[model samples]
Target chain A: MLALRLSRVAHPAVQLRRLAVAAASAGTGFLLLCTFGYALGEPEHSGAAVLRLSWCAVPLAATVYLALAVARTDPGTRPRPGLSALGLGPGRMMAVSAATTALACSLGSLGALLLFVQLRGGLRALPLDGGAARVLAAGRPLPVPATLTLLVLVPVVASVAVALSLRPRDPRRPAAGRGYGRFGAYGTAGARETFGAYGRFGARLRSGTGPQAPAAAEGARPASGAAGGRTAVAVPAGPAPGTATVSGPADALAPADGPADTDREDADGPADAEGLGSEADPHRPPAPRKPPAGLPWGVAVLAAGLAVEAYTSRAVTLSGPALSGTRTGSGPALPGGLDVGSVPVLVGWLLTTFGLALAGPGLTHLCGRLLQAVRPGPLRLLAGRALMEEAGRIGRPLGVVCAVLSGTFALLVLGRGPASALGPLTALGTLVVLGCTVGTLLTAAVEARQDRSATTAALVRIGAPGTTLRTAAGLRAAALLVLFGPLTLVVAYLSALPLAP
Target chain B: MVAPPDNDVLWARALHFTHNDGSPALSGVSLGVRQGEILAVGGPSGSGKTTLLRCLSGLVPAQRGEVWFNSTPVHTMGPLARERMRRDRFGWIDPVPALVPELNVWENTALPLMLRGTSRRRARTAAQEWLERLDVGELTRRRPHQLRQAERQRVCIARALAPAPTVLFADEPTAPLHRADRAHVLRTLTTAARSHGITVVLATHDAETAALADRTVPLLDGRCVRTVHLPPVQDTEGRAACSLSV
Candidate 1:
């Protein structure tokens, strides 16, 4: 039944769901860590310490759970049977997971700090010298209550914030145009426009439309009217240069027009020849051509700048004063303060963080440029077609496998804990995943509907017959998979949770 | 000797046409261009004259109907096989610039051969010979953008003929050229196909341009209205007018 379900689901959505599940699992893992920490050594009776730990743990947990839920609800499923798994590569999955974890941890920490500060302020009213610390540490049976409270609150705040912030915006909403008041909206629109432009450029390259113009100009007669000169060549009605066109063996032999001929032919076409020359002005300039395929220099410059900064920062740290001994200045410096001893570690961390931050954008940009340079012809068309088909086939099965694994892991973890723990954890995971899946599906459905509308507009412009029904069907299947899969898993988990004796 | 019905047929079986925007450009418009025959479709703008060529070559989708190659439907085949069919069965040259401008004359001419999975070295060698035959050998190393108008036309013609497709569709091939260049391009196209035993379909609005084809069919709106046969022209030496009929 698991295999059957997996077979029906698309791959990318499943992978996305798995990622969400993994995030939630990480939160569970963090909880396990805290529980184990408490079991190992109970901290002294200090309210501040207990508050700090709880604040940290709570947010981490919340972020992970929320992320998982969000992932579960991603409403983008396609019936890609065999190659669905390829949609979310292992590397991409790991990266997304790591980033989500870090973000959750950071947010949780901030929330915990805020609560710690608030509690400290309230505790100041007490008579104790270290009132803030004592109150945090105060709790029956080894101050576990305070610690648990901090752990739970920290993750909850962080998770809630992240869930709200990262929620995918409705794609159909009319994006705000440029201006200061609408800066956020405009930024999103700009990013979308850039993405669309890049996609179009890539498509043009894949289609072989960019590089062929120059070649076409050479063979045909000049566009300028010359009496008794070589006749202008007519444009052929076949595939554009550099564009992918499906054709049988017969298409390989047609005569193509040169640039000069193409221009002349356009001039002679019935639209131009009707001497509607007023509307069909022969001298009308062609649309501005986009830049040829190559890497934009700005990215390279930015990369170089980052590299220089990284090197200089590392060098400065290495050459700075040693701090093995006590500081000459007022009172002994804090143990964790920046010093020569910690310089190497700090440098390494900085380097790693900077490298990680730049890797995806740099690589993607470079690859896009490279792909552009390599003109698409017969080979690219064949490869692209094959890849798309294969991806469509494999995308769904992988998602199901991942989901099953996640479910099994959750069950194992729940079983290992006390009965009291099992009920809450199971319920929490199930509800989170279900809610996220539904939200994601709703978002995706709305977006798909908008896409269908856009496609309709484009078709109308070209006077072509639309395929709304087919597109709608595809989107519907996607929405169902995204929404139902997590809901089912959550229900199953809740049902299977061992009841308290 | 008359060719077999199947041999004369350029594309066997049905046809399908689909545009990118989830729209049907030519909804299963199918017809055949036989060996030694010229087939024409005349239509108003947007009647899908250019689209028909795209469908025949698999650039567009049929959405329905089988696009057969030698009686085998190409629509049912895999992408690689379909590409191979495009490379080896029919030569296509669109009205727009189709030659890779970055590539020199030889590279552009040998594209089809290269696409057929031919080795680069071998393809270039064959391309060189074709350029020579097309009388554009002097421009072999020149990029397409650097060549003159007439030179570019000849180079495209050379590229199309190099792979020797069974049938060729020239969509408004004479539309861009002046009277003189137009005549020269048409003459070159027809004569070259005749020698290679390739069928040609030249879609044009000009009546004079249609007269250049062995047979012309008027396409009004989206339907075929009439078919006309033109008188034969003299051979290379102007020795005699050959009687050509399809």
Candidate 2:
């Protein structure tokens, strides 16, 4: 199974691209850290500092690449480039994701062990006492055992747990409606019926009333009358089946049956009719057309959010002070040594903040596009429907993942002593992330439902049928499932990652 | 042969229809189709035969009077209910191939069944049987675009019959065939529909084809003026031969 999954991942061109990008980023970071070490006057522990910087580059590269991959992946269709295309059941996909995460954690732990070994050598070279050597050695053993255990067990346990516990049910089977019980008001068949009714009414209003007539009259009349009263000659017939012929004067007289009574009412009616015919036919005027509908709210919201994030990230540059520290930046300042001027810090902050802000609107736009592809409609409502439908499909799994990861990270960070003071702050940040996700999903749902209802009502007035309405609903539902599922997963993972807090 | 008595209540009153450009396509057309009878409507190109069929099916609106489908005012019914009525009761065949191109012949045939929520396997089995009956079972796996004109027509016919609709409105169903194929098609349609007690309302310009019907009504400029009835031919048994007319 491991080989099969890995092979699937290998097939994507994205994997190679990711590896290349990670290598480049780490190489650049290593070079910069080496420059800084040399400029700092080659301290006794300079080699250790260089090793620590190099070790840190690995996770930085991995995190950056993963963020880019997740952000760029379109949620509504086939997996993005570089993702395994093994046709793994949803269950298998979940397992694969878990395995990937565990692998990353193990790699990070190994890098940390290398950093500890280098730091220990540097400490011994600094002429520290025998006690310090013993402490450094003891600390060196600590990270090694942890790193070894993590490398072996993390992926295995995560893969097995995910495969067993979160295996996706067959999509063809009916899914249990989230947040609603079996007989709940929201997801019952009756709701479908109501929506169906609204959709049918809308389609009828759109088709209009001008075209339908008995086949006999439509086929027979043109050849027999008017247009210089030409003799009704039959056209060369094709060979399919069932043919008939029609006569001319009969068609002219058919519509004007009450002309006799009208003639009696006005002595000049016949002459008037003759004069009218000579003056150009008036029976064929065109009908007026309807106006187009306006844009949907969901689309508007998404656009606005994207604009805000773009503006804000560029506007605020965190610099100029260290908030009463020992110096400008000695010792682990700001909880995680995250220098504001550092490219990684700036980039990580920008992505995390901007991505969170854009999440709702992005989801809406994605959903809308998916719906439009399946069934043509206004973009705004399509987006709204997409957002709602997707949220429902992915909400539970995402919530569970967020809760578990945040809890685990909190436990690990708290166990690091002195960092325990920041535990509550991290918990608060996790809450904020979860709250944003839930809020975005709920907003999308409400907007989509509203748009569908409005469109259906409009179609009914114009004379559309139930089938059209049902089709629209189905389109909305499918769009939602496609656009929001992966997005929710990404959000959950991001929310659980260790931040400055 | 004696003429069948005319039923005034069954006749549809004259009505006018306008297009989107302030021009009228159909002007005051009137006609009637009785039970167990075939009504033929023939005209030149752009004579509004297709429009007339749309009006009959409640797909298009009429400017005047009521359209009675088994005595129900079709125009007054809600769009949803009207659509349901159309799907359940009327089988419409358009001149253009109307099958969804993505679906194969068997899938297209079983579409109505699937729409009605039948299990896919059962619906497909039924579709297979229907295709065999139409002598097109060999082409069941092919998509509509992959089939020849005649094969496509057969698949369409199979789709129409799959639902066993009350009335089948065919618009120039034979317009794409050759001479020999046309006669065979006409014979097959008439024979098959007769066996199923289906009323066929066909629009065509061929008098020879009209002669095959039990009764032929002529439509001139969107109006039905006269009707012709043909006697049932005697069979070898000579026991008042059965005629499939309506």
Candidate 3:
């Protein structure tokens, strides 16, 4: 009841975001209904029916992704200081967030049901009825139980995902090693690390399970893994950048040496210059000693994704000699005589998306560092640091956008010079995935901007000319575009070439 | 709108301004600041001190009236021109510290200078010098999130001073600091302005802060109640007994 009231009173923008979630859910639900229709249309081809059902997963994932993104950015769900007095603590807020997501998804599911019923002629006399009768198997009686099950899928899965993501945990629990590592409004982990610390590997970096690269650390390294397997480190947050005595990974060999040297420097370094000991400054937040991790992991994921796609395509192509009888359960060629939409190819595409999402934060951080690599003027330096800080919040969504675009382009390439293998279902799926991914990216950008508004106001007061800020914004956008555009095109080409007829 | 004297670095006449919602913010207030002089605009909260500073600093144009900086008609300037003017010659410090959260202390301090096309190296050196003077030199590499409110405020002050603008508009610059820190920062600011010939227009409700100025203009309900005109530089000592009565 409280969730419903909050939803009703939310800001129009917040309402709009919730509506977007509902729309995504509707699309996913529609896809599921269509999958069942395919099964009804061709009862003999159960394998094909299963294949069609699996295709719905793409839209399903997209809907859930959009729902979660919207939930994170929802102002009403966010916890405030005094709210705890009224029994709305972190745990309660998480439940509210989950409930809110479920409500939105349920609305979408209901919309999907109405639309499906109308199209299938269930509501015979309703306005705007009649279309896709043959494809929807309108001649047959729709199974009430299955239809209801498909409709509930989105809301159930979306709410569960939201609940799991927002579940309150002890900050010291480092073993979970999942989700983005970005700090949220409450400074809870992965409020955004740029859609976040780019998931599990980012968690690994945050928890200091991975070795810190010496160059990135600049000086004395921090201790690996806090007491009781926490992300917290015992070293000082501020270390002198000039005190590098050793090179390479510090955690790998001589892990003990890192703390000893760092403690001495922390005592003798900033403490003296600050005219206070480390114990004197109690307000400083613990700084991450190493640069954000996950770049290598992202690269590896991309390579593996491409390799899987390439191998799947090659195996499909090489099996051509045996033709109809011996292709080993690939569910026969499509009407175009192409082996596209096989389960292996689908798995490869998903991996590519995952890889791109994983690599995003690390790549964004690197972009920031490179911006300030040269003796950057104020513009580059400001732009660079902002990117690095926001890498976690924006990077993963950015990666997903890349994955969507590349997949769309690659599939188009495969469908060329033929009857255009993109059926209505394929087109609808593409549109939903494409729209949701872009929406997620744009939403993440908006959240990042909101987070940075105070700093922006400070810049304005500091007499930073309007043009300079715009130019910096342009530079950041252009850098990301330059980085992602080519990579997208390259991945598209590599993935499509093997699958192409 | 009589022309201000050439010697007055900042001069405002009949500066009537209204907030966007139609509330009066500044009402026909007038004041003049001579070259290298520290002028304090003293008032209680919502007495238009910040609005007055904004008008004088080219951050906002007065709804009505004329403002001149060294004989240039500021009120006549467009937004871009005013923005350019602010960037080139004016510096501002807000009541609270608001450094870019992502940038480290030195980077934040050097931001304005770098915006003016100064080399990063030169900006860093000047920023370091000002930061060291303000007792925050050691904190230069720290991000704003890691610093205390008072420490961050000092960095803001350092940032404002690093560019060495022709006029510095400090609006409750030390509000976040405790007594000891406030006194130390104000001393550094006033003494530095005196030595470097940087004209300062300080806005404060604190009597001690206003006491550092060479002249004071007190305002009430967006209208100045009284203004104490400055005597010749040779006739008065450096301190000005500026305050509000009523």
Candidate 4:
């Protein structure tokens, strides 16, 4: 009841996101119902009915993913200080988020039932447009038990996933030590203390205290203040080993290190980072960009996936009747299925997706490095550094989006043929996949921005022109577009090459 | 149409500001700083020192007041124009350090210079130099997460100083540092301003910090109650002599 009350008073933007989740749920529920209709209509062909039902898994997964994203971002469910006094702590909030998700999904399922019943002419006595009975298998009786079970599947799966993902962690124990949550962020805790806390999909951090900056900057220096003004300035340290005296106000105005003595890192090269290799020198120059580990695995998986797809396409025997020849084509991979079985092509696409998710952070890190490559001005350096910093958090979702786009592109390209065809179910399934991937990406981006609100406020405080920050954001977006656009196109072409007519 | 003084780099007159919630922040505050002068606005919290700084620096427009930077009337400028003015001519430091987590010390320090279109190489050289001055040059490659509170504040100081803005507004700049670190950071800030010929308007409740400034405007409940002028610190070197005026 509290959850429902909170939902009513939520910010409009939060309400919009919830509505989207419901819409996604409704779409998935409708797809499942359609599968049921097909099953009832073709009772003799249980094998084909089961295959069609199995294919609904994609939309179901998409809806669950969307629900989880929405739950993660819901501010009303975010744990707050006084909430614990009212038996509404992190654990309670987790439950609330899950319950809210279940509620939305349940509402969607009910809507889907109404729409399905109306479309199938089951509610003929009601005043509504009750048409499309033949297409929906209306004459065949839809079983109550089976329909209820199928309808409940989305809410149950989605709510459970939401609860598990938002489960509170023990304050004392580090996340990475217990077990790596999804995205392997916690798995890398032994590597860097800060990685897991800041990873985009790692954990739901407490609001306002997302991640610590660990500001303990102790360095060797002469005592300077009121006592040793001139004496302190004289020991110009290794940074300038150049004797730019810090005497009176006049001498300090000149650069400590003249142009000739600039550090090697200033140039567009990794020469300064050659020997650093993760060692904490305190005084050594900065290291080169250290992208999150998983690039190799991602590349290998992607290669294997594409290899399987290409091989299967070139030398396959169509044991099942060609989908186009006999039945309404199915299978999430080949939406308008062209004689391909579910297992082989699906495996290839799954591998490709997993590989891309694994490799996303590294590619994003590289893009950041590229932004700072040539004599970058402040905007480029800021955008590049920020991109590199957030690659872990944003990369995986970005990769998933890229994978979905590639698949959709391949499907559309393949559909431009005489043999390949897209039925309404296939299009609906495609819509769910696209919407969920894009929604997840957007949610991750919002999380990243919230995590850095302090930094943004500080930047504004230091007289940084508003346009500079805006331009930096633009630069980061452009950099990502440049890197991912061509990669997606190439991947799409290669995946489609195998099934092209 | 009352006008600002010709020699004052930053001037605010009859400044009044009320919070969005209708709580009064500043009421009829007025002050000015000469070129190369380090003027401290000394007040307890909620005394309108920060609000006065915000108005004078063109960060926020006062509800009813006049602000002038040199000859330009800042009160009439649009948000964009005020932003441009602040970027080109002013620097600010918050009580707590707030360096960009993603940027290394040098990159963070060089932000303002770069924002002004300075090349990365030149900006870096200047940033490293200022960081060296603040005794954090070795840590230029380190990100904000690696630095101590004081170190990050030092970097923030470096960033403010890198551009050598016409007016530097520091609101309790050394509040984050330890007692020992505060004096050192304050001296560094003042010395850098004097050397660069930068005008500074600092807000602090600490007498020690105010002593470093050439003059002090003490505020209470959004109004200046008294003005305290200190003898030239350069002439006295480490010794401070106060002369009070009401």
Q: Best candidate per lDDT, number? A: 3
Q: Ignoring the other chain, what TM-score does chain B have in each prediction?
A: 0.77, 0.82, 0.89, 0.90
Q: Which stretch of 10 consecutive residues in model 3 chain A shows the poorest summed lDDT?
A: A241-250
Docking verdict class for candidate 2: incorrect
- Writing each residue's lDDT as its tens digit, candidate 1 over A1-501 gives 322243245467555544443444344444333333433344442442343344334324334444544433333321222333765433333333334434444444444444443433434553533334333333323354644554454344544544454443432335434244432344443443332232232532332343344345333222222211211121133344112121211122122323434454343344433433223432222222233222234234334533544454455446544433323344322112322333343333333223322332233233223332454443432222222222212222222222333334333443242222333334444444444333333433344344235323322221121233344344334433454356335523432232111
Candidate 4, true inter-chain contacts retained: 0.57
Between prediction 1 and prediction 4, which has the larger lDDT?
A: 4
TM-scores for candidates 1 onward, in order: 0.38, 0.39, 0.78, 0.78
lDDT of 2 by residue, A113-227 (tens): 4443444454455333233233244332333343354334423443444345445443232533433343324434343223223224343332222222222233323422341
lDDT of 3 by residue, A1-501 (tens): 889988899999889889989988888898899889878977888887887787788789988988888888888888776897899988999999999999999999899888887888778788767577787888998999999999999999999999898887654323433333322324333222333122234443433332233222433223323221221221223263111111111222234335444443443345434444333443332333345577888889888988987887688667764543333354644422345434576677778888889998888888888887778887888788788888988898999999899988877764363325667767887888898898888889888887778778878988888888889888999899989999999988887765566
Q: Indicate which candidate wins on DockQ.
A: 3
Candidate 3 C-alpha error for residue A360, in Å? 1.7
Question: Which of 1 and 2 is the better model by lDDT?
Answer: 2
Which window of ten consecutive residues has the lowest lDDT sum in model 2 chain A? A283-292
Question: When only chain A is evaluated, what TM-score does every model earn?
Answer: 0.30, 0.28, 0.75, 0.73
lDDT of 4 by residue, B1-246 (tens): 677778887888888999999989888987878888999999888888888888888888878988888888999999989988888889999887777767778888888898888887899999999999989987777666555667778898999999988899999998756799898889899999999899999999998889998999999888888754646556655444453543
The residue ranges of model 3 lying beyond 4 angstroms of the native Cα positions read A1-16, A40-47, A80-100, A125-128, A163-290, A321-341, A414-419, B21-24, B226-246
